[model samples]
Target chain A: MAHTGKILVTGSGIDLTLLRPLEEAGNSIVARPKLLSAAELKAELRDAVAYLHGGEEYASGDALSTAESLKVVAFMGIGYESFVDVDAAKERGLRVTWTPARRPDAVAVFTLGQIIYANLGIRNRLDERYPPQWSAAVPMPSELSAQRVGIVGLGSIGSRLAGLLLTIGCEVSYYSRTRKLAETTLDLTYRTLPDLAAWSDILVVLLPENPSTVNIIDTSVFARMKEGSILINTARAALVEPVALGNALRDGTIAVAAIDGHYRDESVNAALMREFGPRLLWTAHVAAHTRQSMAAMVDQAVRSVLRALDNAPDENMAVGQ
Target chain B: MAHTGKILVTGSGIDLTLLRPLEEAGNSIVARPKLLSAAELKAELRDAVAYLHGGEEYASGDALSTAESLKVVAFMGIGYESFVDVDAAKERGLRVTWTPARRPDAVAVFTLGQIIYANLGIRNRLDERYPPQWSAAVPMPSELSAQRVGIVGLGSIGSRLAGLLLTIGCEVSYYSRTRKLAETTLDLTYRTLPDLAAWSDILVVLLPENPSTVNIIDTSVFARMKEGSILINTARAALVEPVALGNALRDGTIAVAAIDGHYRDESVNAALMREFGPRLLWTAHVAAHTRQSMAAMVDQAVRSVLRALDNAPDENMAVGQ
Candidate 1:
C-alpha cells in the first residue's frame, strides 16, 4: 500500500504541499494541475491505484473501464455524484469517497451572512446615487432575533446554519426527507415543506441537487411562502426553479431572494438581473470556498485515498465494493 | 404626576401608539411629528413640562433658555450630546435622559453581518459584467471562526458583539477606557489600543463619538494594524479618520474596511468611493435602525419623561439636578 503504483490529482491551484505526506509515504504522484479532458483522464487512470478527483473532469463509465489498476477514487468535494460514475466504479471493485469534513461550517457562515444582508435590505442601496442619509422614512427593519426562519433541508450545512441562527435568537424550523430524531434535542421543530414556507419570515433552501430535489422550490412552493419573506439558496441553483423565483420577486410573493452561484442558463440570470436588480442577491458559488474549508477538504480527500488503497475502513466512502 | 402639562414629541415617524401609555396616564401629548426649526422648537418648549427630543433641532443654550416650564428632556436616541446642551439643561435645573434599551443587540447584529460580508470579499462581484463563474483562482476566504477580532470599546454594543463573535469561535479582545471585571468570565481579553490593533486580523471600532474618542483610529492605529486586516465601524463616523483610512487602503496596510453610516464630509466619501471602490463597504448607517429598537427607544423615552416629571428615580437620566 505504501508503494502504490501512482496517485493522480486533477485540480488547479490546490497547494500541492498539502499532499507531501502522501508523497513521503512512497506513492509516486501524477499531478494534473487543471481539469483534464475525458480521454486525457482515462489515459492517466490506466496505471493509477488511487485517484484524487478535482470534480472538474467527468469520470464516466468508459473512463472507469480504462483504469486497469485503480482501487479507489477520492473526490475533493461533497457532490461526487455530479462528476463520478459511482455504479461503474463499484462494478470495477473501486471504493469511492467524498470530502465533507469542513464544508458545513463554511457554507453555514456564508449563508448566515447572506440572510442578514438581505434581511437588512442593504442590496437596494448598494448603487444609490447620493450618500445615505438618516431618515425616519427609511423603513425600520425587523430584528433578526425575532425572525421565524424555516430551513428547507436539515442536512449538515442546514443544521449548522440552524445552530448559528439559534445563537442569534432566530426561531428555526426545518423540512427534511426524514425527521431527525437526534436533532430534536436542539429545539428544531419539524415542518412539512408547505407548512415551513407558510410559517417562515425567511426560507432557506439547502437540499442537494438530485432527481428528487431538482427544482424542488417551484411555483407551488412560492404560493405557500409568506409575503415579503426572504429566500436564500446556497445549495445548487437547480434546487430552485429560476422562473418561479423570478415570478415570486416580481409579484411580491417573497420580498427578496439571494442565490449563490450561477444558474444553468446565463440568459435566465441576465433577464432576472435586469428585471429584479437588488431584490435578487446573486453571487458566484463561493459558499464553501473558504481557505480553512479548502485545506481540510484536501486533507480529508488525501486521507480517504490512503485508507482506500490500504483496504482500511473510511467513513466518507460513498460507494464501496 | 398623572396630569403633567404638555409632553411634546418632536421625532418624526415614531408610531405615536407607543406613547399611548403616557397619554393614558393623563399627560397632554403635544405632537410635533417633524424635526422643528430652532425658533419653532423654542416656541413650543415655552409651555411644555416634558420634551421628547428627536436629536434633530439643536437644543442649544439659547433654545433651552426659552423653555421656562420644561422640567425634563428625554432624547430619543443614545447620542444626546450632539443635539442637547446638557450643561445648559443642568444650569436650568432640568433632568436629561436618553433611551439606550434594545439598541445594543440591533447594532451588534448589523455589525456582525458587515464583518462577515467584508470577510467573504463579495463586494467586487456586485457589478460583474458577466454571471459569476467558478474558478480555481478565486482566493479562498478565511473562516470567521478562526479570526482574531479586536474591539475598540467595551460598551454595551461592543460587549454584545464580542459575545456574538465568541459563539462563532472567534478570538475576541477589547481596548476600552477601563477593564471590565464582570466580562472577564466571558473569555474576553483586554489589550491596549495599539496592541489590539497590531494583533487583530479584524478591528472593530464601537466607541461613542465624544471629544476624547474622535479620530482615535487614525494613522498611528492604522500603522499598528496587521497588514491585510479588515476594519469595521458601526459606531459614529468620526471615530475613524477618513483620510487615514483612505491612505491605509491605498498602501495595503489594510485589505478592506466597511463603515456603516455616512462620514462628515460628502466630498471625502465621494472621493474615497471613487478611489477605493469595493475595498470600502459603506452603508447608510442602519445598524440601530430596527423596528424593535425603535419601539423600545420610544417606550423608554416616554417612561423617562414621565419619571422626571413625577420626581421619581430614573436610571436613563444622563444629567440630573
Candidate 2:
C-alpha cells in the first residue's frame, strides 16, 4: 500500500520517469536536479525512506549523521568508488547500494568508438579546413588489426571493450589488480601496467577512481608509453594528471589523447583545451549516457530503492540485474 | 627472360615501394605522382607497356591509341567504375585491371567508425564550444544496440560493414543489386531502396559508382528517410546528390551526415560547408587508405601489370578476386 515515507531523488541526468514506479508504490518524491552539499541535504532531510543518488554529491559521515530517518541510499551509476562514503553508511547501520557494473555496454561502446576514432585518424582525416590530400595531408590511418591495444582496468566495461576490439581484429592486453583465468575464446593477455604501456600502440584507461588510482597515469607512465602512441581515457579524471597529460600531448610523447571523464572542474578542461586544442578529443562524461543503458540504470536504481523500503533482503538487489 | 617494357605509375596516394615486383620482374618504372591529362600522358606514353593508374586519369580511345606499346592499365585503388574507359580499353585490345573490392576491410572499418560516430553523436558530444550540462546542451546519444541501420548497395564493403554492425548489436538491413542467399549467421534483412530508407534510423551508402547508382540518393530518397535519421557515405560520390543532402540536413530530414566520399569537384564540399558545417562529418576519400590495405592494393596492381606484360591470361586479372 501506501509507503507514506518521502524519497529524496538527487541527480543531474537521471530520467524522472523511472521514479514513477516508486510513486505508484505510494511514496512521495522530492527530486533535486543539481547535487546539494551534505549540509544542504541535512537541512532538507525529513522522514526520508531513501535517497536515490546521482552526480558527485557526497554522503559523508557528517552528512549521514543528519539522515535520521534514512533507510537506504542507492546510486544510479556504476562506480561508487570515490563518490560515496560507504564506511560511514555502514557505521550508521544504514544500507548503501549502487548499480555496480551498470551500463557497461554504453561505456564499452564509447571506449570502442574512441579507439576507432584514434586508430582511423578520423579527427585529422575529417578536418574541413585542411582537406587531406592522401600522402601529403592524410596519411593512411593505422589498421585496427595491426595495432596492440592496452587497457588499464579489466573491469566489466574493459572486458566488454576487449571483446568488441577482438571482434575487429585488435590484439588486446590488460593490466588489472588480478589476472583473469585464461579464456580460450578470447585472445587476451594480462600484462603489468608498465609492460602494457610499453607494448601498446594505443593505451586505454578505464580504472575506477580510488586512492590507489588517483594520478596513476602520471609522467612516469607516459614516459614508458611508445613514442607516437595514443592514450584514451574514458574513466575518471583522478586517474590521470592533467599537467602531465597536457605535456605528453605537446611533446609528442603521445600522438593523440581522447579523454571523456574529468574532475568536474572547469580548470581541468580549460588546461586541456589550451594545450591540446583539437588534438584532445574531450567529452563531458556522457560515455555511459546512452538511451538504453541510461534507462536500464535508472530502472535498476529505482527498483533497488523500492526493494530496500520493502525490507527485502540485501541479496535480492544488485547493479543492472 | 626479362620484360623490358616501361610502366607508367599515376596516382596521388600510392606507396611507390609496392611497384618493386615490377622492377624485379625486369620492367622499368616511370611514376607520375600527379594525375596526367590525355595529352600529357600521350607525351609520356612512348614505349610504355603498362599504365599503373590512380586518381581520375582518363585512358580514352585517343589516349589508349597513343599508348602504342600499352598492354595493360591497372589501378592501385578499388572501383574502375566511371574513372576508366573500360569499353575503349577492350576495343583497343588493352587489358583493363583494377584492385576492385581490394580494400573492403579498410572501407568497412571506416564505415564502422562513422557508424559509431553518428550513433554516439560524437561531434555534438565532443564539441567544446557548447559546454554540456547534462541533458541540456548534450543529451544521451542513441544506442548502437537500439538503432535500426539501413545500408544501400550490400556489395563487398557493405556486407563487411553489415557484419561489423551486427557485432556491435545493430539491426542491419540492406538494398543490394541482388540478395545474398539468406545467411542464418548474419541477422540482415533484404529491403527495397525506398522501404529501407523508410525503415531506418541511419542510412549508409557503399554502392559502387555506375550509371544506375549516380545520383540515386536524391531528394526523393531523403524524403523517404526517417525525420531524425542519420546518413553515412563512404562509397562513391555519385551515389548521393550533394544539394539534396544539404537540403535534407538543413530541413531536419536528417539529423547528421558523415560523408567520406564526394565528387572531386570542390563545389560539393563548398556547398555542404555552407549549409551544414559542423553537422556534416566530412572526410576526404581516405576511407580505404589504411596502410595495410593500400599496400595490398598497390601490390595487386603492380603484379597485375607484370602478369599482363608476361602474356598471362586475362581471366586471372579480374578485380576483387
Question: What are the per-candidate TM-scores when only chain A is compared?
Answer: 0.84, 0.88
Task: Give a tens-digit lDDT track for model 2, residues B120-168.
Answer: 7787667443224566545667788778999998767787788877877
**Candidate 2: misplaced stretches above 4 Å?**
A1-11, A25-49, A62-69, A129-131, A134-139, A181-187, A316-321, B1-7, B23-49, B56-69, B101-103, B127-139, B181-187, B314-321
Off by over 4 Å in 1: A1-13, A19-73, A91-95, A126-138, A306-315, B1-13, B16-58, B62-72, B92-94, B126-138, B306-314
lDDT of 1: 0.81
Residue pairs clashing, model 2: none
Model 1, residue A59: displacement in angstroms? 4.5
Worst 10 residues of 1 chain B by lDDT: B127-136
Query: How many pairs of residues in model 1 come into backbone collision?
Result: 2
**lDDT accuracy of residue B227 in candidate 1:** 77
TM-score of each: 0.85, 0.89
lDDT of 2 by residue, A216-245 (tens): 999989889887888999987668988888
Interface RMSDs of the predictions, in order, are: 4.3, 3.1
Q: Reference contacts recovered by each candidate, as fractions?
A: 0.41, 0.50
